[model samples]
Target chain A: MSAALVVLRKELLDILRDRRTLLLGFLLPALLAPTLSVLVPGWTADQREQPSPVAVVGAEWGGDLVYGAQLEKLIRVVAASDPEAALRRGAVQAVIIVPPDFTAQLARGRSRIVVRYNPADQNSLFAKQKVFQAVAKFSLSVVEQRLQQRGLSRAALSPVEVHEEPIPAGGGGLVLSLLLPLLLAVWALTGASHVASDVGAGEKERGTLEALLSAPVARPALVIGKFAATLALALASTFVAGMSQTVVTALAPAAWFDAAARPALRAGAVLLLAACAFAIAAMAAAWLLALSFFARSMREANQYGVPLLLLVMIGGVAASTLEGVLSSLWLAVVPFVNVVVAMRGVLFGRVDPAALALTLAACAAYTGFGLLLAVALLRREAVIFRA
Target chain B: MKSARVLVRAERLAKRFGTFAALTDVSFEAREGEILGVLGPNGAGKTTTMRILSTLLRPTAGRAEVAGADVATSPQDARRALGVLPEAAGLYGRLTAREALRYAGRLHGLAGEDLERRIEGLSALLDLGAFIDRRCEPFSRGMKQRVALARALLRNPIVLLLDEPTAGLDVVAARTVRRALAGLRDAGKCILLSTHLMAEVERLCDRVVILGDGRVRGIGTLAELRGEGGELEEIFVRLAGAGSVV
Candidate 1:
């Protein structure tokens, strides 16, 4: 164990001094999350705040439905002789056509409104949504007016009332939860790839493996030490990434996070996230180390690592895209997927202790298996002395 | 007179990579206070023999020992007693020579003040003061070789295995290595040195083991093998056969 610690210290010192490892594992990941977090929200806000113009046909016959209360504040309604041409020419994002007899039908309590917009166009889509909101409000006012004329209470317009309330409801945390797993997994892979390949295949290519093997330290000690260094790097990178994301989210405007619905960034939650990140980092580092041991050179190790990284990324994406708790017992033991699910559960304050335990146990098991494989590979003369 | 104590012993050691025999029935011994030379052509199994003694490679058919520790059964102990500089031993390019040496020392159980002192001593002994603090990446081949040699010697093991230590060095660098080997030998360390240069073998070896085609062609003192007037080269060529020396 002492020998392994020595090896770990040396390997870490060596890796830290390497500019390539520092850049890829530490600097890049630290910068990526904050940069994206700020830029994406800013861009989305700009898109949402922009005015959406729409063209209206038969404006005289459309009556108050076309010029309803406060509609002009949200949308710019323009009268166009040829609304389709105006829409196609980009003069308007959408077009609303009113029939010539639309006033007669409304007096008899019947009418139809046609909304035309290109779904593929973002501006058109936004315009369509604004028009729909205005129309719905106008229809509600007409119903209230008719009820008043009949001398009936406004409540008589509806026999039933419905209200929606989400379970474990929150908004700001939703984005963070959706992003944390993928970002952490990516950081883990980035960190592990840099250190694991350098220690495993890079040692062989540089001819340093023979000297290390000839030392009094056993092969398992050497492997464990290298594995520890890689794991440390992996965990450090993920922590930095997670921290950057948290800081960025906290600094963002309340409008971006729905302040009332944002969950407090509590110490217990942060600690749980850190624990999950550590488990993921350990699993990533061990697996990458094992794969790299089979490679004869760093280049070959990178080739093997790319596929594993892709697999991790896909698993993270799949988990984040899944709705609800993701507390299925089977998914709790599925490596990277489990961590993502557990992270989601933790962020939303709906954690299933049993599932989290299973996930952690599974990660521990996989990490152990990976380390054992790495040790076995290190002991092989063919691998250690590969030409 | 005190009997010579053998520090390294390879008894009928053999190694096979699949069906190809890299070393066959190779046997030799190096005693304390002596420098034993392993002389061979490029593909003559000299490196294979050195690797087995260093506990870096396991022999297929025989056993070896370093400082009385079995290389096969107790490899860690055997390795603990051996300082190995394999052919083309490479350094961590990102590390300074001092850091590299310290790392190697720590691996051998040296630490703190002892490791630092060992590094200082080796840096001075190998004339590494000029570049010891520089990263090894931009080092010349000769400078790297010196650092590697320093790393191998840092632990001061009972047995030293140097494979082609000066194979690609300039005359000055080669002389530096030869001087270091002589110093270690005089300090009573058993050194097993493999080389192709006849001059290196003639100048340093107390006894020479000439190998050819994975087999030992001859093992004896130069005087014994040279007879009354034969040159060491002629004897080597005669024993190892024609077209063997490169």
Candidate 2:
């Protein structure tokens, strides 16, 4: 164990000095989650704040009925000889055509306004929504005015009044429940594999492995020590990524989530998340180390490692898609998928102790098996001396 | 000679890699205060022999031991009793010579002041003071070899298995390494070095083991192998079976 610790200390120090590994394993992962979280929302909000430009045909026909009081704030009226041409050329986000008989129809208590917009363009789609809201508001105001003139209550327009109260879904908001687990698996796999390849096949390529193997240290001790280093970096990356996402989620605009049902994580949930991250990182480190040991060179290690990375990432995505459906004891025993399910359960505040125990146990078993395989590979002369 | 202890022994060792014999009935011994040279051409099993003694490779049909610890059965003990410098050994480029030596020492269970002292002694012995505190990435081939050698000798094992220790060095550096090996031998350390360089054998080996096609062709003191005072090259050429040059 002490020998293992010494090797661990040396490998960690070597990893720390490696700028590429540090950048990929820790700094990049730390920055990626928060950057995406901030950027996506910021970009969306920017788009929402800008008014969409639209061309109005027959603007004078309906007067206030055509462009309602909320119309100016929602859209900018752009001049266009051909409204459809303008919309297709992207000069205007949408074209509002007010028919010559709109006023007559309004007086008759019914009217149809044709709002032309490109469905493929985001700006055009948003403009369409705004125009619809504006027309609906104008119709409602006309109804209220007529009702008041007849001495009827304004509430008559909404006779079957509907009130919506969002119930907390137990899983921290939908995005967090899905996004966090996928992020954890990706960070853990990438983080562990980065250092694992460097320490395992990199040593073999550099010719340092034979010297290390010739040491009095046992093969198990050497493998465990290297595994510990890889695991340390993996855990650090997952923790940083998780914390970055958490901070972003905490500081995010409440309007982004269901105002009535914000995902709140308790202390117990946090502990379970940590345990889940640990299991994921441990599993990645063990298997990645085995793959690295199987490879004879760093390039070969990467060739072997990338497919496994893609496999886990695809599994994470699939599990996230099937989140609720994957809350079974059987899924808890699956490798990468189990992590996604457990993370979802933790975030959803619906922790199943039996399933969680099975997931953790299964991860531990895989890790042990992987470490044993790595040790066995290290002991093999053919692997150690492979081209 | 009988009073001297045999620290490295390879008894009728045979190693085959899936039918191609790498070492076939090859055997030799190195005693205390001796530098036994295993002389061979490129494919003559020199490295294979070194690897077996270093506990890196297990022989298929025979046993090898270092200081009575069987390399096959008691690898940890065998490794503890010997220090190896393989032909392709490399240093951690990120580690300084002192750091590399200290790491090797710690692995051999040496620590603190004792390890430091051992490292300092090796640094001076191997002429590593010029680059002891510097990282190995920028070191020249000679400097790298010296540091690697220092790392191998850090534990002061009873037997030293070196495979072509000065294969890539310039004259000055090779001379420095050769002098160090001679000093270590005089200090009662058993050194078994493999080399294709005939001059290295003529200058340093107390006894020479000539290997060709995975079999021992000759084994004796220089005079015994030379057989009535021929050039070492002619003897090597004849024994290695590459045919004579003219």
Candidate 3:
């Protein structure tokens, strides 16, 4: 154990001193989550705050429909002789063309208002939504006017009323639940990948493996020490990412997320999330280290690492999509997927002790298996001293 | 010679990579206070023998021992008593000589003040003072060899296995290493020196073992081989099969 610790200390110091490894494994992962959290919401807010430009064709005949409503305040309405050209030139997000018989159709109590906008353009899509809402409001006001003329109640227009009630609703925290698992997995992978390859295959290529193998230290101790250093890096990255994400979520404008669905960021929940992150990091570090040892060179190790990274990403994506099935105990036994599910459960203030225990136990088992494989590989002269 | 204690002993050691034999029925011994030179041509089994003795590679047939510990069964103990300088002598380019030595010392279970003192002693012995604190990246080949030698010697093992220690060094650097090995031999350390250079063997080795095609060609003192009626070069060329090619 002591020998392992010495190796761990040496590896950690070496990795920390290397600027490239430090940047890729530690610095970048910590900064990415916070940067994205702030930038994405800020950009969304900016887009919403800007007035979308729209061209009102046949405004003379449809002046009441466009100008009478409060939509003009939110959208910039312009008169364009060639509205399609204006849209193509990016001058307008949408074009509202009123047919010459629009008033006649409205007088007959049913009018078709064609709203054309580029679906590929995000601003155009936003403008289309805004115009649709304004037209619906105008149609409602017209119906109420007709009812008043007929001396009847406005309720006659809608005989059946539909209401939507979400089950166990009122928490907008689902967005965080969906995003946190994927971020943690990414952080764990990025943190462990470079360092794992450097320590394993890098040592072999540098001709240091023979010296290390010739030492009095047992293979198990050496493997454990290396794994410890890798785990430390992985945990540090995940911790930074998780903390940054939490801080960003807390400081972000409430309008950016569902106010009702926003999870209560309690200390207990945060602690649980941190525990899950550590477990996932440990498993990932060990697994990555094992894979790296199979490589004969640093370049080869990186090549092997790419598949593990892709696996993590795929697992994260699968977990996010499978959130509805998180209650399954079987998923808690799956490696990367389990960590994501358990983290989602923790964030939503639901702590299933059996599932958490299973996930933690599974992670521990995988970590042990990975370390054993690494140690076994290290003992083989063909693997350790591969030319 | 019979009374001298044997620190490194190999009895009919053999190694094979697939069907190709790297070392076959190779046998040799190095006594304390003596340098046993392993002379071989290219692709001979000198490195294979050295690797077996260092416990880096297990012998396919036959047994080897370092400081009385069986290399195959108790590699950790054998490793503790053995110091190896490989042909490449690769160093971590980013580490200073001092740092590298400390790391090697720690791996050998030397720590704290003992590790520091060992590093200091080795630096002084190897004349590493000028560049000991600098990263190994800028060091010349000779300097890297010296650092590698210091790392191997840090544990002060009873047996030293050096493979082509002076292979790529200039004349002055090679002489420095030969002088150091002579000094170590005089200090009663057993050293196994593997190389293709006859001059190094004549200068430092008390006994020489010549290998050819993974087999032992001849083993004796220079006087014994000379008594066989040929110069050292002629005897080596004939026994190592280089004469046939010429």
Q: Candidate 2: where are CA atoms >4 Å away?
A: A55-66, A69-73, A79-159, A167-171, A258-263, A324-327, B243-246
- Number of the predicted model whose TM-score against the real structure is largest: 3
TM-score of each: 0.87, 0.91, 0.92
List, residue by residue over A1-387, the lDDT tens digit for candidate 2: 289999999999888889988798878887897666554764676666677788899888858855663355777788899889989999999988889998898888787778899999987898898787777778778888899999997787677888987776655666677678888888999889889999999998888988899999988999999999999999999998888887777777765655433557788888999999999999999999999999989888878878887888788878856655754798988888898789988987788899999999999999999999999999999999998
Q: Write the per-residue lDDT of candidate 2 for residues B1-246, one digit (tens) a residue.
A: 558999888899999999899999988888999999988787888889999999999999888989999999999999988888988878888988888887888888999988888888888777888889998888888888888888888888889988889967899889989999999999899999887778888889999888898999899899999887789988888887756422
TM-score of model 3 (CA atoms):
0.92
TM-score of chain A of 3: 0.89
Q: Once model 3 is optimally superposed onto the true structure by TM-score, how far is the C-alpha of residue B97 displaced, in angstroms? A: 1.8
Sort by DockQ, best first: what order?
Answer: 2, 1, 3
What TM-score number comes out for model 1?
Answer: 0.87
**Candidate 3: CAPRI quality band:** medium
lDDT (tens digit, per residue) of candidate 1 on B138-171: 9888888889999999998878999878866789
By summed lDDT, the worst window of 10 consecutive residues in model 3 chain B runs over B237-246
Clashing pairs in 2: A170-A348, A171-A348
Clash numbers, per candidate = 0, 2, 9
* lDDT of model number 2: 0.86
Q: Worst ten-residue run, lDDT, model 2 chain B?
A: B237-246
- Candidate 3: lDDT of A190? 81
> What is candidate 3's lDDT per residue for A230-340, written digit by digit as tens?
888888888788777767776777667655455566677777787888888889888889878888888888788787778877887888566576555888888888988
Model 3 segments beyond 4 Å from truth? A68-74, A78-91, A152-172, A261-263, A323-327, B226-234, B242-246
